[model samples]
Target: MSHLSPRLMRAMDVAAHAHRDHRRKGNRVPYISHLFGVMYLASRVTDDEDVLIACLLHDTLEDVPQEYSEGRMREEFGDRVTGIVLGVTKDDSLRDWRTRNEAYLRHLAHEAGDESVLVSCADKLHNLKSILADHEVLGDGLWSRFNAGKEQQQWWYAAVHKVTSRRLPQIGLNGEFGELVRVLQRL
Candidate 1:
């Protein structure tokens, strides 16, 4: 088991503050919940302090760069944490939704290392659970909350699963992720 340190707590605080105004897409739930969910899921797999911290802050660089720049992350959390977060962040410069997502998928297949893959798997796993729950309530309406509709979303999740499976086959989380993907597809 990995012991939680002051830095881990600090990461939670920073992520909370940075995402304070943000909400889950098309919902009232605070965005920090997703960050915490990712961190909690990752914690079940490894005790690495940096990976946990990276999980907490993974979206900051992509979603709220103004609040938490790479420089700030490096200064506060150090290089490995910053690198893992960067590895998972989508290329917002692409503008087109499909283009950005494909870039991310390519990164996962080619460039992302174990730590990045671990954080991404946890993040996607949490999102899949939320999507499944929300789908029960909203049914087809839930697809409106996302940039891509059902088909594109399915493709993205499956692609992420493929990369994670190849990248971290030993990690049990990949199995859960794949199961969730299958569930989502059947919905």
Candidate 2:
């Protein structure tokens, strides 16, 4: 069974506060909902609290550096959780979406640990679910929500599934992610 210590509760506060004002793209849904969704999905696959915490805070460094930095995260959650969060974070300084995503893919393939991979798979899975759900309602208009359009989005999700599935072939989430990527490809 998974244990939720005080540390996990503290991480929840940190994530909720950091993303308090943010909303998901193309809609007004609270961004913290996505964080919680990732944590819940990761929880389904593993009991490691650190991985679950990383799932909660995965987007902090990328989305809200002003609210939470690497140093602050380390001070609050220790190295392992911080490392996993860093593993999934992309360098926002790179303005070009392709350049940013390429760097992220390299980090995911070479530098991320198993914990990071697990959190990333959960993160992507939650994102895919959100995208598919939104697409069903918004149709092609949903593509406008992202920085990159449909083709680029397809490329990125497919590439992520390829890397994540290879890294974690045993995880059932990867299988689901691959299937979702195929569904997205057809749209």
Candidate 3:
């Protein structure tokens, strides 16, 4: 049987509510679909219940309704789940998106073994894969907005390589992820 319990189910419901009106950039697909994709990818690695739950709700505190406070998250899902979610949540007080993202990535790189990394990587891999797929449809505009610049792009590729190289060896060095990494390196 799957390890997803009633608490996880409730948490997913809360995330769905929080992101109800949201859509991904470029395409208007429901944002929760992205969360599902990340969870699916994480499932391919370890079935650690906390990791799966974190994958499902990683963005709730960041992208969801303002009412979804850390306190509410702790009350509903307990402190550990809140900690994992907060570990991946970006501090929006930064003046620039790139600075915020860089700090977030640096934090992840520092907090190496936290289950949050698995969710964060799965989340990033999902976005990267979508960016690759969307590139054919959106053309250069999407890449232009997402890439930040050649140096930032190269740093991103290198950072992803460092994390995945250390953490995802069991996920194998083949398939969509491997191809995506190669493409990022070329950018």
How much is the lDDT of residue 147 in candidate 2? 85
All candidates: CA RMSD (Å): 0.9, 1.1, 2.6
On the 0 to 100 scale, the lDDT of residue 136 in model 3 is 68
**TM-score per model over all chains:** 0.97, 0.96, 0.85
lDDT of 2 by residue, 5-94 (tens): 898888889999999998988899999999999999888889888898899999998888889999998998899989998899898889
Flag regions of model 3 displaced more than 4 Å.
1-4, 144-154, 167-178
lDDT of 2 at 114: 84
Candidate 2 clashing pairs, residues 3+ apart or interchain = none
Better of 1 and 3 by TM-score: 1
Model 3 clashes, total count:
0
Question: Which model, 1 or 3, shows the larger lDDT?
Answer: 1
| C-alpha RMSD (angstroms) for model 2 | 1.1
Mark the regions of model 2 whose C-alpha exceeds 4 Å error after superposition.
1-3
Worst 10 residues of 1 by lDDT: 1-10
Ranking by TM-score: 1, 2, 3
Per-residue lDDT over 28-78 for candidate 1, one digit per residue giving the tens place of the 0 to 100 score: 999999999999999888999999999999999999999989999999999
